[model samples]
Target: MTRRIPIIPTAIVLIAAAIMVRLGFWQLDRLAQKQDMLARFTAAEADRTVHPWPRGGIAPLGYTRLQLECRSAGPAQPEAGRSASGQSGWAQVVQCATPEGAKARIVLGWSSQPAPATWQGGAVTGTFVPKGEDVLVYADPPLAGLQPNARPDPRDIPNNHLAYAVQWFLFAAIAVIIYALALRKRLRG
Candidate 1:
């Protein structure tokens, strides 16, 4: 009597392996894209050209230095943050109305206490750091007698696609090996 391979189980295993392999390739593509983005950010940091505060989206202006006149400012809100010296502290942030009537968040400075800083608003210059849907302007000289907030650096952003790709590929190889071993054992039995 001849033992035949189980068709359904083999097909399922193959499909799963193929999916994993595809996912690995996708991650590789993401890795390339991330590298390109980081390169652009690094170049932006070296650029000293200060641009007017963006009125709309801030994604493309990330890492670029910007100057804006704060027509008016709201109350300051101190959030947990880090100082430029790598010390744990609170970042004094406030919503300010620009000359263009656009709202912008300014990281006035850092403080050891959570007490909000007093800043009426004035001409501010800083680098644009993209955070989620919003952008934060980390004041270069800081404001309200508070400590300096950490400057934005492209290196701070993590690029883990390579590791993710390796994990997916390993999972695919392991799945194939385990299925082959199980099938061989069944045939012998």
Candidate 2:
């Protein structure tokens, strides 16, 4: 004797599975877009011309180098950062007064010791990096006696889209298997 799957439950499961699959594809698309952005960032960094710091409240250009004269405003704040060699250590960040009389933070360098003597800030050139809502410049070779910090890495940006896609596909497979098993049990009964 042949048995038929329950129409209502089967239809619901199929619909849900399709939605999950679509979500997986969407994540994949996002992954591609993120990769393209990273490539553009790398290209921008390669240009050596120093761009002036943005005036007013405008956001600084990402991955571009800047040349500016600024002096130490107050004291240096210690923060966590990585060295060029990928070693973790404390970095000295000091508030600097821009030529335009605005305050901006400058990452002097990475040191094993926290709060290294205040760096004599003057004519400075560095790459501007954006961490969340805040943007700070990383002195390429670093000033003071600290080690050089690693260049901003696009690869470091998280791309978990592939994992998310796998999860959605797995959910679809499980739904199909469970429905088939339920149908078999009902037929036996």
TM-score of each: 0.91, 0.76
Per-residue lDDT of candidate 1, residues 40-91 (tens digit): 8899999988887754644445788888899999999999999999999899
Each model's lDDT comes to 0.90, 0.78
**lDDT leader:** 1
Best by TM-score: 1
lDDT of 1: 0.90
List pairs with backbone clashes in candidate 1. Answer: none
TM-score, structure 1 vs. true: 0.91
Where in model 1 is the C-alpha error above 4 Å?
55-59
lDDT of 2 by residue, 1-189 (tens): 777767999899999999988988988888888778778777768887787775565666668888767755457788888888888888778878876776667887888777564776776678887777766888766877778877776567787888988898889889889888888889898
Sliding window of 10 residues with minimal summed lDDT for model 1: 53-62
